[model samples]
Target: MHNPRSDKPVLVGVESLDNVQQLVRTAGDLADLGAGTVRVVTVAVKRSDSPFRVFSDETIVREFADSSHELLDRATTPEGVTIERDVLVARSAARGLLAAVEETDPAALVVGWRPQEQRTDAVFGTTVDALVERAPCDLYVERVGHEANGVDSILLPVAGGPHVETAARAAIAIAARNDARVLVFSVETSGDAAALAAEGREALAGVDGPEVPVETTVRESDDVTGAIVDEAAAHDVVVMGATRKGSLRRKLVGSVPRRVVDQTDRTVILARSGDVVGGPLHELGRLLRRW
Candidate 1:
């Protein structure tokens, strides 16, 4: 199915001018995915001497905003994409982006994902973790350094869930833009390789439009993450769906996508198709409905 939100505006959080190239490239990819406009946002704090200070660092902030737009004009805004610039002066990057999201409810919020020393507590970086938990819209965390190579070869892994269609739709849109191919990989299940292959093909067929070439593979592996990581090395990017609703499944088998993020060298996109739920409270609703 085509993404319902693809034609909506996209909100991108610009970390800095250094990341302008990649950020713009991602915005273009979103355009191919059906985004009508890209709103580039940045955050800066104003310096103030005291409550009596009438002229806060308004000049400095204005200069920053001007420079930001210049950078976007030079490198970020592509030929056919409508671009909007926004600067928010907030305490932190997360707060600034959240403010922008509140003001302009974009279809998806795109942010950079930098690899950092693994903290024992958080699987993703601080900003991403915070946004994933609370963002009002779908979130796309683009891993830096793995710039898409014309979307030449895209990797999408699916076992069985809601995210399968979501990820497939994204891959199809991206591939359609670059005239690329999509490889859909799935771990062996049901102890039947042929059956798995058949199922995988059917799933791919359901999502695969005439826009791009798509292929499917099913392999047996106890280490699901290892298999995906190994396959990801040869692909331009890996798009995986978030399984936020299945806590029981996560507790039992762990999160394959989280592990894949840590091990893969290629760009990883954690695509969420809908609004984030209110954690345990959301789960409670599901339980109550079962009664």
Candidate 2:
């Protein structure tokens, strides 16, 4: 099925000018595919209400707004994509981004991630961690990598889930923009590998978007994560669905997408569809994590 949010704008939350090109480019491609606009946003922390301050809160906000505009100016937006810029003030970046989602109601929220030493205690960094649970729209987390002159191939690993369609659509959009090819890949631990491959092909067939060269591959591997990481070495970008497991399980065991992001040097875009299935129990788990 086609993404229901395709007609809405894409909201991108950028932390800094560094490594923001990929984030903006990805957002632009998605927006371009949907014939929508891209809203690039940054958050400025509101100054504390202390009695003593050298600069007024208004002055601080003005400075931040200027810097934000400069950062937005430096972004390399995709061709044929409409772009908008904004600066939001909130106590925290996560809160500011969540607020933007509420106000703008974008089709999806795109953010950038820089690889760091994996923390056993965290799923993603602070801002992303908050959005994973609370954001009302689809989420795209791009793991920034070394600059690439162009994109010629996209690796899309699918295992059949709510987010598969979203991932496929993103991969197809990016491929259309760059004249690249997409490989719909799957790893079967047991059962029939042929059936798994067929399933992957079907998933790609269901996505509606600009036509692009597409291929499907299925392999038998006991190590799903390793298989994906190895295949990613040959591709410029990897687009895959976020784990369907509950948040608590992901926190403890780590998801395949998370592992692939950590192990691969290639840029990875993890897509999570907004049709969250976990009911009240899932919400309770998220709340407990906050405490």
Candidate 3:
């Protein structure tokens, strides 16, 4: 499942100072997994012409680029990994990031996320959500905090779906570089626990995390999200797949990943399988709901 030819750059979308360290760590992880260049990108709001305009747009853009470079320079780059800095100005952060993705065509887009009390504006609830829906390549959203420090132990939540297989590949790629342990966690609400556990193990057996040890467990729980949150508390990172089911409205309001980001302290990476699905109206409604 690992692409030997995927030597493309890994683009990281960094927002604030709070997430810079986390984003840097993520870019390093990706670089270890055969990705060549690590591009760190930040977006600034595009100012429109107005009577109150004080500074020229060119000056503002230069200042923003300079600030972004300064902040990214604080990050430590891994060996063999080239760090590239990008400053994008658009109507919003999400639009700016999407434009970058289009230009770069990266192997994956790494973004940082933190729980917000309220986000009343934006199309995808937040920039991360919007990028998830629109990004051309695979997406990895890292939840930033004290819990997202290291990659010693990694968790891969699987459900025996196509996305699960994709997620397993992602886990193997990431674990290979860090020598991290892979814990294949699954929840059994209706089926046999033993069967689910077996299936989880089989899904990960082909991709053995590049010599990294992998363990599988299937627990019975009515609240899947709650179970994931509890398990994540014990692990450093939880790598899961992009959600396929659920209404656009629900995805906008609150999806499994969103819930996990809000409730869990551990870092998360939502892996996509490059499959095109529909739900633009759902996204549009959610964006409109904020107004």
Candidate 4:
């Protein structure tokens, strides 16, 4: 079932100006869908006090806030979408972003993923890893692709999961903004392919948003990740839900989504429903694993 469109602003967390246009654009579109604003936020790490330091903490924060505003100024926000900018000071990027989520109470939190080459050890990255388990709002982790010049077409792969509805809504919101078409594709290895196809169609049908053309397709493939990766080549963007896994396993993007993000160059948006929050012990375990 589709939930009502949230009127809360969409919050986008950025580390730098690099590739932030796509993120801001996506968040702007999502905000436009709900008649809300887009708040672009960047975190400034608070450095420890040193007697020999050249600049004071206040000076450092001022410089960082200036850079943050410059970054926001560079972002090409969608027309008719209100945009706000902020620079948060915290011990780490993850802490700053989590604090922003708590203060803003946004409907969705948008973040970017570094390419595999840039990050080899963590699943997504340090900040994203922490937010994946703790963010209190829906999460959209974008892996921007060079080929995704425009949102002319969207590839949305669905399987029954808590996040399918959110993914569908996101796809539709983007499609509506770009006047693009959505292809709701599903892969089934066995047992009632037609049923799964029907469910895919229903997922799109239930989304409440601007009218956009949507098509559903089901293909039988022994390799779900390979199928998604191959089909993703035909579209400009791929929007899919996190895998259906328990909370601990959910700390990382499901294996399929992780592989798809790794394999495909198409701009991928991995959506996760925010209904589940990991407890303190689980959070501690994840931190230890990362260390």
lDDT of 3: 0.69
Model 3 spans with C-alpha error above 4 angstroms: 1-5, 49-59, 119-124, 192-209, 249-254, 277-291
In order, the Cα lDDT scores of the candidates are: 0.67, 0.77, 0.69, 0.80
- On lDDT, the leading prediction is 4
Candidate 2 per-residue C-alpha lDDT over 1-291 given as tens digits, one digit per residue, 9 for 90 to 100: 344336889999988788667788889888886756888888876646633245655775677777665676777787677788877777788888988987988888998877668665557777787787677778888876654568999999877667777777788778988999999888887776567566656666666666788898887799999999999998998998876665553632238998898788887888877666347876786578568
Off by over 4 Å in 1: 5-7, 45-61, 118-120, 189-210, 244-254, 278-291
Please give the lDDT score at residue 164 for candidate 1: 58
**Weakest 10 consecutive residues, lDDT, candidate 2?**
245-254
Model 4 bad stretches (over 4 Å): 47-59, 118-121, 145-147, 246-252, 278-291
Better of 3 and 4 by TM-score: 4
The lowest-lDDT stretch of 10 consecutive residues in candidate 1 is 245-254
Ranking by TM-score: 4, 2, 3, 1
RMSD score of candidate 1 (Å): 5.7
Candidate 3 lDDT trough over 10 residues, lowest sum: 245-254
lDDT of each residue in 1-291, candidate 3, tens digit only: 333436788888887877786777676766666565888888776656642246665665688776765676677667777888887767678888988987988877887766566665442356766776666677776667644555787888765444565566667766777778889887888786567556656656665335678887788899988988899888878888756556653342236766776687667777764444236764575467457
The candidate, 2 or 3, that scores higher on lDDT is 2
Q: TM-score of predicted model 4?
A: 0.87
- Write the number of the candidate with greater TM-score, choosing between 1 and 3: 3
